[model samples]
Target: MSLQLPDVVETYFAISNGGDLSQLASCFCSDATVFDENKTHEGLAAIEAWQHEVRQAFDFEVEPLQALQEQGQLTVLTHLAGNFPGSPIRLNQVFRLEDDRIRSLEITPC
Candidate 1:
């Protein structure tokens, strides 16, 4: 089934697919956090840096397939393909949003 995501989540995917770090950074709150690759990046600056590093290191695209919301969190299943070790993979991106901004996000293999 297709999931109807929040505006913030939709914006996140849009900016991410566009590959605009600056616009992506604007999708989060000042104290937002991102958990990926066993690392936690906190705050906007760190998030921007992490995005920059990852974007530069791998040429990739993310296609959000579905989303599920529980409590205050939303988990989205996405298909990612890139130049990384595993060329293509499916992952779950969990997002916690507050005040129309993403407060935290965690990504894991699906």
Candidate 2:
């Protein structure tokens, strides 16, 4: 399927909800990078490994609240929820897409 910036975010939530690492990996470039919380991960291999590990821990949903785009990037506001108290977490996802795959993602809690 052809991927777009919004598709990147939606696919993330979908794969995450299904706990599918392979599907998640497909959304990224081979050298895609992700910055979450305070940690930075380089490459789809690392992102896939990280997702595999973290998916076992958190069961949050990437509930899209708002979305904005400029140039070739998209910034999405979402709610993350799971096992923790006050589980519903608000966050922002900044996505940069290259050839329809996510080239970079920066996530920050709101």
Candidate 3:
């Protein structure tokens, strides 16, 4: 079944919290692109690879504080905390969904 933006976001949180790569891949479009402060990943292959790399680098949880849909984008404010001092990073996760999957994702530290 096709999922809404919120559903996709929730799935991402679940998969991330669980560190489940397979589950995480399900939420992205076949041609999805994800961008973070360091790098950009394109397509399902790159996204999955990047997910694996990120999961290994950080032990954290992305807790969504606010989620809203505006102008074809889903914007979320989240708190990220884990193996770092003052790590509870506040960030924005903005997503663009296409065909019920995430087509683009941009994360910015806030």
Candidate 4:
């Protein structure tokens, strides 16, 4: 079944997949933060830089397998495959949206 996602969230996945990184400003709030790999990236510039580093290092594809949203937070279970040590793995991405834009996101092992 196709999971329904909010417009901003959909745009986020689109950007992550193949869309232009310049479009990130439209998808994330100026103060957005992303936590991954034990590092916290704050602000759009930092988030973009983090994305660039991860995309360059892993070249991974992320597919959302399941999702649940409560209040302003959405948690998605994703399958990732790439050049990393583990060819494939599952992770949980928790996103907090504010004013229709992503305010924060935390990625952790499932």
RMSD of each: 1.6, 3.6, 3.8, 1.2
Show model 3 residue runs off by greater than 4 Å.
1-5, 84-86
lDDT of 4 at 19: 72
lDDT (10s digit) by residue, model 3, range 3-106: 34477777887877765788756799888899987689988999888878777787887788887788999988888898856798999999998876789999
Local distance difference test, each candidate: 0.86, 0.79, 0.82, 0.86
Error of 2 at 54 (Å): 1.3
Better of 2 and 4 by lDDT: 4
Give the runs in model 2 whose Cα sits over 4 Å from its true position: 1-5
Per-residue lDDT tens digits for candidate 4, residues 1-110, read 46788788888887777678888898899998999989999999999998788778767778888999988699988888888896699999899988889999999988
By TM-score, rank the candidates, best first.
Answer: 4, 1, 3, 2
Tens digits of per-residue lDDT for model 2, 1-110: 23344666678878867646678667999999999869999987789877887777766666677778988789888888888567788988889988878899999987
Reference-based TM-score of each model:
0.91, 0.86, 0.87, 0.93
**Worst ten in a row by lDDT for model 3:** 1-10
Best by TM-score: 4
Assess the local accuracy of residue 89 in candidate 3 as a C-alpha lDDT between 0 and 100. 91
Which segments of model 1 are wrong by more than 4 Å?
Answer: 1-3
Model 1 residue 106 lDDT score: 99
